[model samples]
Target: MTSTDATTSMFERIGGSDTIDLLVDRFYDRMDTLPEAKTIRAMHADDLGLIRDVLKRYLTEWTGGPKLYTPEKGHPRLRQRHFGFAIGDAERDAWMTCMRGAMEETVTNAAARQDLDKALSGLADWMRNRQ
Candidate 1:
């Protein structure tokens, strides 16, 4: 069987948009205080409200729920959007650190966590716009 057949869609595994919303909220909370995330946090504005919603919607579509992100923000073009930032190894790691922590806190299912981790890692690497 193919990987898709073997694995559950991230939407179902993640308990849908509500769970992802919690994950994104927790991620930003950690980023707001974590020293490791300071640099990356600096890239964002003081207000995280919009970012939280954007991330939740983005994740909702990315995880196979509904295509809310595109409907609202057009194509994701994640690399293009992130290209404006100085995303080097440090920034990528910092983002991943917060996300990993959030995942650990929000996702109780081992398989779901693994799936989300793998997808996030790939997306993080893809978002790296600078060396």
Candidate 2:
């Protein structure tokens, strides 16, 4: 008989910021080398340090942690921020591929992983700026 409290939330169970940081790091690392990610990769500067940090912070707030990103960056107009880039199906798919790989490597809970993946799939499609 396991108490429900014995189970941690995905956000807490994954070791919080540390796990998110590792995932973001691995995600950017994959982006650096994946041929499919070349176009999206080119959109970013060579240095991925800041990008990784921002993503980690963003995820922290997004996944029921402290409100890190909102206080620092204000509203996260995700679509507006990404509007500068031509995000077609290819770019969206590439980004999702990297994220999926990273998620698989970092996240442990089956339900949590599925929830995040489904949400991400919708968000990635919504971010598409091009046909």
User: Which numbered prediction scores highest in lDDT against the true structure?
Assistant: 1
- Superposed by TM-score, candidate 1 places the C-alpha of residue 104 at a distance from the truth, in angstroms, of 0.3
Q: Compared with the true structure, what per-residue lDDT tens digits does model 1 show for residues 45-120?
A: 8999999999999999899888889988998888888878999899999999999999999988877888789889
Deviation from truth (RMSD, Å), model 2 = 3.5
How much lDDT does candidate 1 score? 0.89
Off by over 4 Å in 1: 1-7
Worst 10 residues of 1 by lDDT: 1-10
For every model shown, what is its TM-score relative to the native structure? 0.93, 0.88
lDDT of 1 at 97: 98
Count of clashing residue pairs in every prediction: 0, 0
After TM-score superposition, the amount by which residue 18's alpha carbon in candidate 2 deviates from its true location, in angstroms, is 1.8
Report lDDT (CA) for all predictions.
0.89, 0.83
Model 2 lDDT per residue over 26-113, tens place: 8898899899889889999889889888998888887767788999899999999988999999999999999999889988865667
